[model samples]
Target: MPPAATTNLGYTPPDGGWGWAVVLGAFISIGFSYAFPKSLTIYFKEIQEYFSISYSEIAWVSSVMLASMYAGGPVSSVLVNRYGSRPVVLVGGVMVSAAMVLASFGTTIMHLYLCIGVIGGLGLAFNLQPALTIIGTYFHVKRPLANGLAMTGSPVVLSTLAPLNQFLFDSFGWRGSFLLLGSIVLNCCVAGALMRPVRKTVQLKPNTEPQEIVETAIVDSRGQLSNVQTDKRKTESQAWLHKFVDVSLFRHRGFLIYLVGNVVMFFGFFAPVVFLAPYAKHQGFDEYSAAYLLSIFALVDMFIRPATGFIGNTKWIRPRIQYFFSFAVAYSGVCHLLCPLAPGYVGLVVYAVFFGLAFGMVSALLFEVLMDLVGAHRFSSAVGLVTIIECGPVLLGPPLSGALVDIFGDYKYMYYACGVFMLVPGIFFFIMHYYNYKKLDEEQRQSLAVEMKTSEEAEQLKTSSDDETDGRTH
Candidate 1:
């Protein structure tokens, strides 16, 4: 294919229609990617007994899995950028299935860590980055809604997997459960197959035009067109590095703001969820009752995500989405901060309702804000870069929260810390985003002024030449 044709193939997104099918695929892949680790908690007690391990050691299984998933972001991003989402996700599905099958036969904690933690985590990384990235390719106007629907996969899968895992544990034991889970996870491959690559076309206007003009268009894939020049000085090493990671994102003001806020936000994010069941159990609830709390949270979360998405897509919110996201983060923080004050089961349930709403709203807008900041073309790289750095806090958050629990001999202090962590970042994002918005407006006005001046000069020069030609003819 010609260069123009190839460049054009990547320019425009369908924004809807079959894009909904792509959203369905993302929902499946992302659902499994996030839900699997949490669901595996049901097997931890058995695994601990079998391995004769401490709670901390057993806990490392999920921690390592999450860490590896975040750490593998760049590699997955590179693969997705190079080849596309379908193939990478298919391979990820296979890897996750294989990892689970292998874990079913493992004899040691180390074996589980290697199979379920590292390998499985990498597989999820592959599943996650592409699923998020492809949505940006398929939709723009309705993207928030698409993202909201796709993110509901987390709650839906968590709700299903939690109970399914318990039943499987009762029926078949942990080993047999792992085997069955492996089969179930292979459905990600089916979802991957559904993620049809969205091809866009950007056509270049004829060279006879005064300056190069580009337009987003649709054309036959095989059509021939002219070549566009690109920087040729970069060597093999630079090309490879740039292909996978866009290091320049470090300089991006909005992206930096988002990244810092997320790093802080994540420190509090997963820990609360991790400790929720244990906290409820500590409060003298039975295992079933404690687990039911998560169900309530997930159920509320499921409805709110789509609603948040619809609200975000509106003219009122989409333009100021960063503020909306900040509010969600702060809302979650306040809920956690007051969690300790909850009188009893009813209070916790009330807290769960608010937490679910806050969590859903944040999750729905998280990537949308990133996409808004960086645009689609750079979002893949931006996410990859973001995940790699954010992995530290994600890995440490639970342990640090656990230490607070150890110190206080209660979960309340940990909850307090998480609330602070989230709140600070929420406020930071709000203030910084306001300044960023003002700066962006100023920059746009300055650029417009420069363009107007250049156009006027060009017009005046052309008119002077026309008058001189008429005088010579006279």
Candidate 2:
């Protein structure tokens, strides 16, 4: 037989039931974590003018915030492993609210970076990782759909907040807007309170179940004998950090593939959205009209995210979902590459619709694909590891794209860069997934052949023993 699998404390999750409730909580947390940064772009232009900063310098506000969120992934993961999701999320909510409130009083650019970027970003990290991790614990068969539904929070919040931020900026200016945004973010705490932890009874293997024993004794590798009662407990030799972070995932082939693809993918992911508003203004659309484009993108995204999830969960799609994700990425890239062709208000509206569809498809599938590759059991550690590694790309992507804007004095080149970044990774994923699937199939067949041979051997031995016993009796 193949080597026995490692023993772990098993909790066979209920797959549904209260899982829907957890999804609701995830929606709220994830919505804020992603949308908050994007929505803050509304303040970027005014803030840039007020502080006499360049586009790239103002871009760093979101960049620093996103980087901190990604960098804090491991810490967030460790805390979730120790304390669970509710407390982490609640604390994250408080930090975000306080950060926004503090940011409103800022007199210098550094203050905004420290308050909204670092502290607020760290708070968002706490909210984000745990919410995603707990979903793995709560659902298995329905996980893709669950993830999709939860992720719709991004579009819904984005659509609402895009216009809301603009209105706040117009009515009360950026200062009052920041203060109000703080109060709005505090509702994440209320959402966290709803993420009640689920407890399931541990399952025991048949061979390891309690049984009668006689003359209980144990022998060590050194040939030393000891009373079984005293030596019954097995010791784990893994380091403390390994227990929490699961560093071995670095060696997992599928995880490595996912990680590399995601790193490249993120290098262009947020740049287009970050510049979308400014690009419109550069084209002479008024502020409300520019903000309206985001709402349009978000409205389509809101519907598509859930639909994509449902589609992904179907048997035909789930088996080949990696390819689906690859296609989504490529489609998004193609949209960006062709964006320059679109002219005037109608052209931009069409671009927003298509962009929304493509963006939503990728976002809905992102975590679902990761969980499929790494599995629910290891997903917490996997997400933590992924976020930290991906920080470099996530942090630098927008600012680098902004620099391209500064160089060309137009947004078209920035879109071109993002297109290439996304397309290359999409193609890479498709090819790698093809080979990986073939290897997995071969391994499964080999395992099945071994099981069949072992079964036949046992049957033959039993028949021979029965014949011998009959002969002896005769």
Q: Pick the candidate with the highest lDDT.
A: 1
Tell me the TM-score of model 2. 0.86
- Backbone clash tally for model 2? 0
Clashes of each: 3, 0
- Which candidate has the top score in TM-score? 1
Global Cα lDDT for candidate 1: 0.89
Local distance difference test, each candidate: 0.89, 0.88
In candidate 1, what are the lDDT values of residues 78-139, reduced to their tens digit? 99999999999999999999999999999999999999999999999999999999998888
lDDT of 2 by residue, 89-111 (tens): 99999999999999999999999
User: Which stretches of candidate 2 lie above 4 Å from their native place?
Assistant: 1-11, 45-55, 167-176, 201-237, 282-289, 458-474
Which pairs clash in model 1? Answer: 8-201, 8-202, 9-200
Error of 1 at 355 (Å): 0.5
